[model samples]
Target: MAVNVFASATEAGDTAVPLGGSGVAATVDCPDLSERLTTVPEQARPDVDTELARLDEQIAAAYRQLQEAARTADDAKLDEGAILDPLKKERAGTIERIAAVIGKAGKRPEGLDTLAECTLRRTEVATTDAPGGSPDQQRQQQNGKGEEPGNTGNTGNTGDDGDDGQTGDGQQPGNGGQAGNGPVAADYADINSVRPNVVQAPRQKNASTGSFATSCGVNAEGLFNSDNLIAAPGVSNGAHHFHDYVGNQANDAFSSDEDLAAAGTSCADQGDKSSYYWPVLRLQNGTVEQDAESPGGGIEGNAGEIVTPAEVTLRFEGNERGEVTEMPRLLRIITGDAKAFVNGDTNANASWSCTGFEDRQLKDKYPLCPSGSDVVRTFTFQSCWDGRNIDSANHRTHVAFAAADGTCPDGFRAIPRLVQRVVYDVDAPSLQDGGRTVPLFAVDSFPEQLHKPVTDHSDFINVFDEDLMREMADCINSGRECGPDTPPGSEPGQGENPQEQPTENPTKDPQEQPTENPDASDPPAERTATASAPAVPGQDGRDDGESEGKGGGSGAGRNDGQASAPPAQERDDDASPRAEPRAATTPADDTPDDASGAAPAPGATQGTGGGEDAAAGSATEPQATRGGLAETGSGLGLWPAAAGGVLFAGGCVLLIRSRRRSM
Candidate 1:
């Protein structure tokens, strides 16, 4: 029997097919191949081969089952009692521990895992290499684990464990760690550690000259001592103490040049500083008046040019009408030109040549006039003269001086003229005020022999008029006579009426209403009618009832009450009046008529109505009482009562309807 076996093409092609020889007969084609097989183990080797193939199939099925189990375990969702649960938990714990270690390290530590492995390997090596060590040594070698020498892997060397309880370099992780470090100190020690370059800052140059000696001889603390420094003359110390410069100079030298340059640039960018120069006008009279001018074509002595003072005269005049008119007054004299002298050579002997000429004809001739005289009186007078307009044509009238009234002689009058002349010299010190030069010079020297004695008068003489003084005294007396009793009009008490007894009736008397009806429902209306009544009750309670009678009783009271009631009814009937007038009259609106049909009893109604009318006449009647309760009840009056009731009831119905709709 021919057995058929499946084989690769290469093997199949290589299989030998025996050809039938001469002695063998050709066999028929076998259709039932299994029926032709040999039944013995040697004839068919199917058991061993089949058994091997079955085993291979079993192994493949087991591997597939194992793979399916792995996939299920890895699934995000799993049954509660799955066997992989503990293993999954252990894996997750390991991952979390690894993350925690990485987080604590901040940055990954290089070769950390390799170092740990090397350390464990070294421990293993130690355990194997050092067998007979002490218990401690053995424990150390084993790394606290009782494992075989070659089994354990390396763990890294001990390092600082961070705040997160993981091994890393010294610092803790995150912002919390930085805050926990606390504030850095600002002292030299701390600052040097952070910025060592700061200690290398150059020292500032000393600009002080030490003068004061301290207990330490010369205080080495000259940095803060202002007395140790000599400042240039004329330089301001800025304040009483000059020590402030020490700090300022130190800052200037130590601060960055960029900062100083920035400040300087800012200042320079602000442009020129504002200043003021007052216009000065030099006057020949020695008075520094504003806008005064020098005379043209006159004896010129450098009036406007800067020159040294040779001689100057100062004149003082007194108010002739005052008690001090006789006193010799000290005066200040100034001059524009300081180069022209009176005697040409007497610079030191200069004196007032016209001083005591008060008694001579010179006094009467040129009393107030300084021109055509040998010497001029010097005096300062504020003038609105302009220096640009002064010339020889205006010289005589340019300089003027003061004198006694009517002291001018026959044909003379006070006129302005040159007084003291100045002689210039470059060797002399320039005239200055404060620290600035005066810019103008005064003449030097004068003729001393020309001086004379000035007339003197008694200093105690009263120069004022006595009659004028008496008139002033009378005015003061008259002012003092005015008292609280004085009336506004010229006629003291006559213009004002005297206090009088209050009459039985005042002319502008308040109209009184008649007695109201005890049964009136609306007493306010009744009272109003009574107030308008023509007749009123008399003192005797008699009712004359006459139209002309001022007072009456019975009939008058009835008429007054009747008359008062209609106007009130008319007021109540008017709808528009009730709306605005009621609001104006009664703020609280608590009146009986304000409520719907809520009238008081007969007598109570009249009383209440009268009281309300009076309150309405005055200020502050209650209006709120009228509108508030009117919705719930009928009102007392005609139109207003009905209208208010309707409005209130309508408002209530609307509110109810709205509530129903909301519900």
Candidate 2:
């Protein structure tokens, strides 16, 4: 039996036909038809197609499942087992086969003739499953330990394994390499070797007196009563001990019993009895401490109680003498929270006077009141003490203060007050003869607490008048006048002179004279040429001259005759001569020869000369010359005769020229 299949009759016709019942057949009418009989070997074709369809459906299902798994397996919700297990197993087997082929193929596997289909198929599955897997996970799957199939296929790991071929969980030493067992374990055997030693020290106490404990420790009563307390004969010495200890040392250093008694008396005079009544209190630390004292103790006794008014003795050393002075004046005295009269009363009843003891002069002056005075008093003294006065020669003065009764009050102290000597140390070179000295007065009161005097001595002034003169000189030198508007007796227009104005006067220019008259002869020749030509006649026998004249006896003939004559000869015979020498010497040749031929006859010369002279002076001199020529021609009849001759010659030439042309 046989069966046949054909694409077309043209292809089938060349092949032999099979038996009808047992083999495939193609009808002659349907040349392109193909058939397979049950008896033929191709009859199993339908079963083969069915098997292939089943296999294709299975492969398609597997591919779709793979795609669905890949789509859903993001890092956030990956299913490592369901997505990568089968692929990892397949990749391991494929890698083993590839390695075998590569080993047999030697250095270059590219030239080897081998089936790579399995390898490519396995690679596609492995790559899709292991797309972003970590290297360690990939290496674990490569070794065929039946590791969970979900393990990604990747590069093999080269790390050494522990027991059971697994890496140790313990951290390794030195770049994370595994530690050598025995040596590393033995190195840290003694735990105490690595422990740190620490010590705690006790805190020292603070010595600063900022706290109550420190301040309480000081002997307040002893400190307040220091000046009044007596001491034993021998105790502490040399060191800066407490006042009581220092007093004890002072008591021991005295040489005699009298000296010791005197020291005791001075101490008793301090009158600080409050120190004996105050009790010492024990601090919480069990140390004994002194209590602070109140006011009215020691020398500051009964501060508000006013005693008899005490004199504030002021001693001024080194005061300049005999000049009006300005200095700090001790006007009143201030005690503890109270002010009292030192010298003057509230009505300013105190008077100030200075007496030059050596010069025997008395000066009564009034004290200048300061701003803060409560009591302004004045004293009227006839004269001051000798030692308290100063003069120009006596620059230094020592002043001593005395009470009204000339005695100080008991238990009151007085500080020596100094009024500086007002001596001018003149710096000007013009004042080399030496500068003057004067006395300065005390004006302001002494302060309750005294401070060191200011020592800068650069600009000290003494006399008020001298100071006034210096100020005036400065004002003048600086170009300034001092007054309400300007100082008295100053020049009114000083420093304000007006600027002067300038004057102007116009000056005349020199007039220019004619250097030389413009060349007279040159101008005339140019003018003559430019003059209009006169209306005159030609030599033809036309009326070439004027016919009118006063005497009309052939005037033109007479003019012609005169014009034809020689002008030089006529000029020689004339009564009056011409002005220019060139005119006199000019020959008849200067005029045309026809003028000689046409000159007036000799009889008419007199009348013509007058006429010619008139015409020369008139506007038509050329006409006059032509008239003279015409008069000459008419008188001789030469013009008419020459005309006839010219006509005859013209007639003859015409006749001959015509005959010649005709012939």
lDDT of 1 by residue, 1-663 (tens): 012211222233422211111100111110111111212132122232232222222222222222234233332122322222332343334333333444454432232222111000000001113221112223344475452332221111110111121112322111111011100010001000110000000101210100000010111122221111111111221011111111112212123323322331101111111010001112122332211132110111112222212222111111111111111111111221111111111111111111111101111011110111112222122111222222112122222222212122233332211111111111111111100111111221011100111110000001112332232222222211111122222121110010111111133111121122222122111000010111111100000010011110111122121112211321222222112111000001121222221111111000001111221221111122224444423444466867889999999999999999999
Model 1 misplacement above 4 A: 1-394, 397-406, 410-663
Q: For model 2, how does the per-residue alpha-carbon lDDT over 1-663 read when each residue is reduced to its tens digit?
A: 001112222343332222111101111110000111112122332332232223222222233333333233332122323423443344344334433433453432232122111100110001112211111222333454333332222111111121111122221211110101000111110111111100000111210000000001112123322121111112121110112211111222222333432332111112111111011111111111231122121111111111111111111111011111222121111111001111111111121111000000001111111111111111111112222222111111112222211121233222211111111111111000000011111111111100001101100111112333333333323322231123345432121000110101012110111011122221110000000011111100001011111111112222121112222332223222111000000001112323222111111001111222222221111111124646554545777788999999999999999999999
Q: Quote the positional error of residue 349 for candidate 2 in Å.
A: 15
Q: Among all windows of ten consecutive residues in candidate 1, which has the lowest summed lDDT?
A: 117-126
How many angstroms is residue 406 displaced in model 1 relative to the true structure, after the best TM-score fit?
7.3
List all candidate RMSDs to the true structure. 60.4, 72.4
> Model 2, stretches more than 4 Å misplaced?
1-295, 298-317, 322-663
Q: Which ten residues in a row have the lowest lDDT in candidate 2?
A: 207-216
lDDT of 1 at 575: 27
